[model samples]
Target: MDGKKAKQEIVTGGQFTIPGTEVRKMRSRKGDRVYQIFVSSPLEEPPSSGFPVIYLLDGNSVFGTMAEALRVQSRRPEKTGVVPAVIVGIGYPTDQPFSAVRHCDFTLPLPESELPVHPKGAAWPEHGGAEEFLSFIEEELKPEVERDYRIDTGRQTIFGHSLGGLFVLQVLLTRPELFQTYIAGSPSIHWNKRFIQEEAERFAVRLRDAELDVSVLLAAGEIEKSHKSRIPEHAKVLFSVLSELESKGVRAEYREFEGEGHISVLPVLISRALRFALNPGGPHTSFSSV
Candidate 1:
């Protein structure tokens, strides 16, 4: 609507099949530098009404999958019984470096680890910019959606995986008002050796007086531990942390699939996680903790 007709393209990736949503490429200036911005929305129905929205991080990997699940799940409301919502896939344009982008976008603080063999090697050191990333979502992206689409402004949810899951948790704790439900799968709680453990503690104390009614669903697979590493152990500790939150009037649920693995659990469990996360009744015993 401004300088030039910003170029748009049709792309397919992530957790959904967004047939009508066209991808628009834009740029954002963070301080002094510019970063490419890519967003997908329904082309035919810009202002889609009665649809809640799901803002998915890592839209390239998980957006289409989640969209497909919502498509199927929306048809059989009797099965999941959850309302279908619009899927906003946030992606990076070709210009930005993927690792640095995610590293700075999803993390909270630069973590210093005592161990040497960390997953994040030395060169790509940008970390802990989640607050800024959330700001981009609330200020830049959400406003665009609201101006162009018919979205249910009040009912929003966020879904993420691994590091993205860590970002979701950070947003929940720091800005619980942004979304009503939170979904995280196989999150890397081992970040900075469970830095989120301490963040969760602060969130619990703040939530007591705030009375923030938020729902969270944490999911990991039974075989996540079989890799002969510390991931499974981290998941256990993450579960304990979430359980502690539940005891503090924060609605939470935990699910560990019997045979699912880390890489495969997203597709396997996203539907159920979405159901429980968005369910208005808050956390319930519909599924077993073990």
Candidate 2:
């Protein structure tokens, strides 16, 4: 073949997608916003009890990485301890890796006077729709997914990163029973004057009075501490509180990814998060560069 033709063929590309994945759009009854849902099902028949399900945030960015990882790792479950699962990515109807709408969907309500001022003095995007967003998921999305797939509701997991991570903590504190496991990566705990910490305290009180079975994995990049990001310390403190709840049927663990940064830590976190969700008996604390 001619050099030009060969190079052209080498660079040719088409739309890429995970084999068992499908996309659908649904407008939330709680709001005017429409969400793009990505679902990836394992090709193998599910266990008699049904496949575990993971609800992932920022779907446009990480859905493929996670869905494919589950496909490959679950193949050798005896070695990897990773089981096949149905992944549901909740994202906006946009091509962008993350949508501006997340500022609303991922944050909790705060008085206008208490809102943080933008670093550049720009007006912040609309926010404080987390309650509505959570309702949409519990009331609308979960039911839709259950109708279409055989999922073990008792094994559901929800994962989020950054602002999305903040949302995960909110759900865990206020609605711990909604999902069996919660994974928060480099959570933005510094937001809103560290309001989530207070929520954690409240959750502690509730835990004393209620019997709930749940697990949480809090992870952050080691570089975040060197960069003066509050995530590492915040996560550590949250870890301490959660760890004390082991006797209460709460399984909590923490991980710090070596030689990684805020954005770069995602891929490694995804792998570890999957293992943590599927294998609840893994180590409680660890460090890794992979």
Candidate 3:
């Protein structure tokens, strides 16, 4: 090959994709705003009725990891104790993190006075799109995916981590019936002076007024307490309150990964998250691996 061609090949390595999975980019417009959306779905055929679907946040990061996890575990379903399911990761189009858009999509709009101390940065991105994003999922994306594949709507699950994990809790608190199960990995519970506690109170009222059967799996690293983020302290409080929600008909439980902290815990927690999501009522208890 020519020198220029060889250099180009080196710079742009061949594209890689997950086997037996479909990847696509889409645009959603409601009002004057348009958000780039990424979706990854397994191409495998479903059972007689349909496949249970998992809607995970940060598609760019977790979709492949989880799709692969489900694929591997389902190979020996009996041995691994996991069932087949579909994974749908919601993400933006750019190779870079969609910081501004995600901030808007994943958080609540609290007044500056109510919010916690601002982080060490100038020009924060526009945030407080939590409810709007939920509407998009309920009204737009869910229907779109259902039209393409036979999904078990009754068995829907959602997973998120970090800020995304905060979003998972938002949905669980606001609309528990939307998804059958939720996996929250190291959620950002410390956000904005901990408004999640108020939200949890609202969840109790919603539970009394509505019959919502939801299962939540909470996972956090043991070291989060002492980390620079100091998030484990907040996360433990979040886990405790979520666990109390069980009395109100929500099946809330938690698993702590030893020796794992913050960023390093996702991979360790994902496999168990998938297994728990597939079999929410199963007696399987804890995950010891770090």
lDDT of each: 0.67, 0.88, 0.75
Clashes of each: 20, 0, 0
Q: What TM-score fits each model? A: 0.77, 0.91, 0.85
lDDT of 2 at 61: 94
lDDT by residue (tens digit), candidate 2, 1-290: 55665544354567887899999999999987899999999998888888999999999999989998888887766667677899999998888899989999999878878776666789878899999999999999999999999999989999999898989999998889899999999998877545877888888888887778898999999899975457899889999999998888888989999999999999999999888887534434333322
Model 3, 1-290: lDDT tens digits are 55665544345667887676776665555533454444445456787778888898888777778888887777656666667877888887667643457777888997766554556756557778788788888888899889988898988988888888889988887777799888888888766535778888777766666566778888889988775556666666767876666666677778889999887898888988877877533625433332
Better of 1 and 2 by lDDT: 2
Runs off by more than 4 Å, candidate 1 = 1-17, 31-49, 94-100, 111-116, 119-122, 227-229, 244-249, 278-290
Task: Assess the local accuracy of residue 170 in candidate 1 as a C-alpha lDDT between 0 and 100.
Answer: 78
- Per-residue lDDT of 126 in model 3: 77
